[model samples]
Target: MEGKKKIVIGLLGESGSGKDTVAEYLREKHGAKLMRFADPLKEILHIFFDKISREDQQWLALQLRERFGRDIFPKALKRRIENESGIIVVNGIRFWEDYDFIEGFDPGYVIYVTADQKVRWERSSKRGEKSDDGADFKRFQELEQSETEVHIPEIGEKAGFIIRNEKDLNFLLEETDRIMNEIANK
Candidate 1:
């Protein structure tokens, strides 16, 4: 609300829904700066494990919230956002706190990425960054129920822009371009 002029975008999506991919596309195509809530959590995960998993990430997040407070990440991210300008994309908007902080940006938009559960499961299987990436469908379903992921769909309902990522990369990028173009006209 001060002198800085920034277009903030909050990205909300379930695991494997292509949120990170879209953020990267924005970064490369729109010169958008990216900030993720899980960045700090993932940094901590990297310190302890050779291969980080979604389950562990959820566990760590809950632990931190219990030790500190629910606002820990949101507060830290708010500080980070204040320092950044231009097209800034805040990935992993899971909680109300995340959305509330992002709402302060004058030209902000929430982008929700959605895909069929099966398609997302398939995509998750191919991504080896998480140790449980290749987990079976049953396990994948359980992981989706974790606290960190449970609120995604509800929050996604609040998005002004929605992108379906079930198709090819080109289609996803095309949809992304469409949204960016729409935002530009705003």
Candidate 2:
């Protein structure tokens, strides 16, 4: 596998924009291992609260960044993936520092998955995940103004590949496969 390039793909997008779907696609199709920067925070939160809600996760992440450093999650994720081979898909890249840290690994590709706000809201509502339990248009918009959500648009602008996921699952999978091929060939 000397000629096989090990790709580190950072997925960037708003909530319910299909980032997790794309990560799952990469895992199943390309045998890419899935990693999330919030994992460590989630683990720590689970210790304090039996059930860690999405809001708790976000609050903790912000607090950790403010108290510790902006690069805390990125540093932890880099350490976790340092020895991993083949394709690795990182699902929760929120800050510019996260992007830069992943790119430092070489052969890193950031793919930004996006969809219309209405469509994303619909998808989010239909998914019925605990994170979206009481989510509405106004709440979603409010979340977008948060410290973490504010950075995603800029990250999407700078992503190597941008995929608009407004259509069916097959369409998304096909687009993801095409992007994977393009990255693999690069």
Candidate 3:
């Protein structure tokens, strides 16, 4: 296990499926390093704008992918992780291309988190992310139809582990702990 990559967990989920919570749990409890496939895009966009919205990010991703290919962000993140070690949680694996690329890592795995739509909307409204504030349920539903979110369910089917995040934070942490144990013991 030492010779191989420690643990590379690709997380896929919709807007409020607790992917961030799971990633944070891994980092806090298991000493995992957290990553997101969109880090490069976020960094670039951040330089130009004080805060980037999800719609803006989706647009940027679409524009870049059209020019550099769909696998561009995943490839960039892979380079970032190349020399790092320890449990690395790559959040935001919404596309099959992201899953395919990350899972190629020697110790890669994916976990998909899901939650009730209404519950997700409620949580998302208050999460206070730059893009999600002022979002109504109607807007949340609309975002689901966007190209960036369309592949989440399909890509989630490919996850090595799938967990539901309901209304309880304790339940989420426990499930995350169990999943991490199972992954590490592999």
Candidate 4:
């Protein structure tokens, strides 16, 4: 641990699982460093492929992985976080590739947040992301399930802690704080 920079907390969960909110809370409350997988993809797509549709952006993401292999983004993000200190939260982790890539660094903790399906849809609808297009339930489910082809449990089982994000924000925050303390004490 002499050469290790700081503790990293990787949060993996399904869409609308409030991962972003939890990450923000951690940054605000714990003064943790943060990196999100979507930021790089969004920046690259906007700069190089202007006027691309959301669907096309998604397709391009898949193509980028196919071309560079899945770990490119995760490795790049990890490099960006290497100099940081204190707790760091990695958001937007998707595939098992992403998980395994981060696991290589041996993060101090991995937390998987989950919510009820109906709550997830409602939250996603209001989250202001592409998934929040106010579409029908079936359409939304198809779109969401397609984006998250793998099951959350597959990743959650790998997490050191799990938080259900259905209650009030303060309640969720309290639970997150408790879990953070629990992990830090280990």
Candidate 5:
């Protein structure tokens, strides 16, 4: 689990594209190591805030970025993964700069998970319980625009694997499994 060839995977997609679900599945099936970039904010939250809300976490994350700049997470992650090998799945890679940073570590694969706009919006509404108030499609679009640019089409085109998640979960899982097996053999 620790001292195996480090295969870094980047999951890129817009909100509600089931990135987390796919990442979890890959990790469980392949025994891949996992890292979430936003976790540094959560790690030290108790030192700064009494009750760490998501907004608070986001604010602290912004603060860290302000202090450390765009490469903070990736640089930190590089060190954490220095002695680690095998499949290392990076969850929540937000920026293009972050992508380049991870790419510097090794030749890795990017997987873009996608779904139809309606399905994606519905999933976002259901999953964004702490953040969004059930809103119109235009409003949801604007909100997502305010967040990270998903670069969905570009990322998808560049991805080694593309999983269309608008179908049933079982189908998605099967497609994901096939991709994992292929990547593992590589």
Candidate 6:
């Protein structure tokens, strides 16, 4: 019998959609490696800036995409993990270009996690990340609009599986486990 092939799972979602939670679950339960396309930008910010604000990170990410191309970060990540073995859970896939680029690689699955806006807003507020610290409902909407400019909704549509993360942690974990099993069996 042939051995199970390595798989790459690309996570797509808006802010507070539980992509990180899913990735962490995959890592802890299934021994998958967690990687994010934002790592490069974060590394650059760490080197040059004393204190990198959320706006700075967003600006740098956008500038990098605009200057280098929409697929720049995804391509870099692909190259970085090319020789790896086993499951790789990639978080923070926002654009169709990112989807297409990663999909071109072998044995990849794109999973879109979705939650209602009100639920997401509450979660984001409770998390209180520096970027989301002072965002009111109007500000949240504005930020979400800017985020949508990257074509996240279209990317979500392109996903192989859409996981609605509206319920509790147990439900999310069960759903993630089911998806992982399906991917492994494919």
**Top candidate by lDDT:** 1
Superposed model 1: Cα runs more than 4 Å off: 1-4
Per-candidate TM equals 0.94, 0.93, 0.94, 0.86, 0.80, 0.90
Stretches of candidate 6 off by over 4 Å are 1-4, 48-53, 147-150
Measured with C-alpha atoms, the lDDT of residue 82 in candidate 6 is 84
lDDT for every model?
A: 0.88, 0.84, 0.84, 0.74, 0.73, 0.80
Return the clash pairs for model 5, or none: 4-86, 5-86, 6-86
Residue 112 local lDDT, model 3: 94
Better by TM-score, candidate 6 or 1: 1
Question: lDDT per residue, candidate 5, 79-155, as tens digits?
Answer: 77777778888877777666776666665878788888789888877765444436668876765553344355565
Q: Write model 4 residue lDDT over 1-186, tens digit each, in one string.
A: 224458778888776788888999998988877888767677777786644444555576688888998776787786677778767788877777777766666555778888877787787777565623466667667765655445566788887789989998888899899997886666
Please give, for residues 61-151, the per-residue lDDT of candidate 1 as tens digits: 8898879988778887887788888888989987777877777678779999999999999999998879999999999999999888888
Predicted structure 3, TM vs. truth: 0.94
Q: Supply the global lDDT for candidate 6.
A: 0.80
Off by over 4 Å in 3: 1-5
In terms of lDDT, model 3 sits at 0.84
- By lDDT, the better pick of 4 and 6 is 6
Better of 2 and 4 by TM-score: 2
Candidates in descending TM-score order = 1, 3, 2, 6, 4, 5
Q: 184, model 2: CA deviation in Å?
A: 1.4
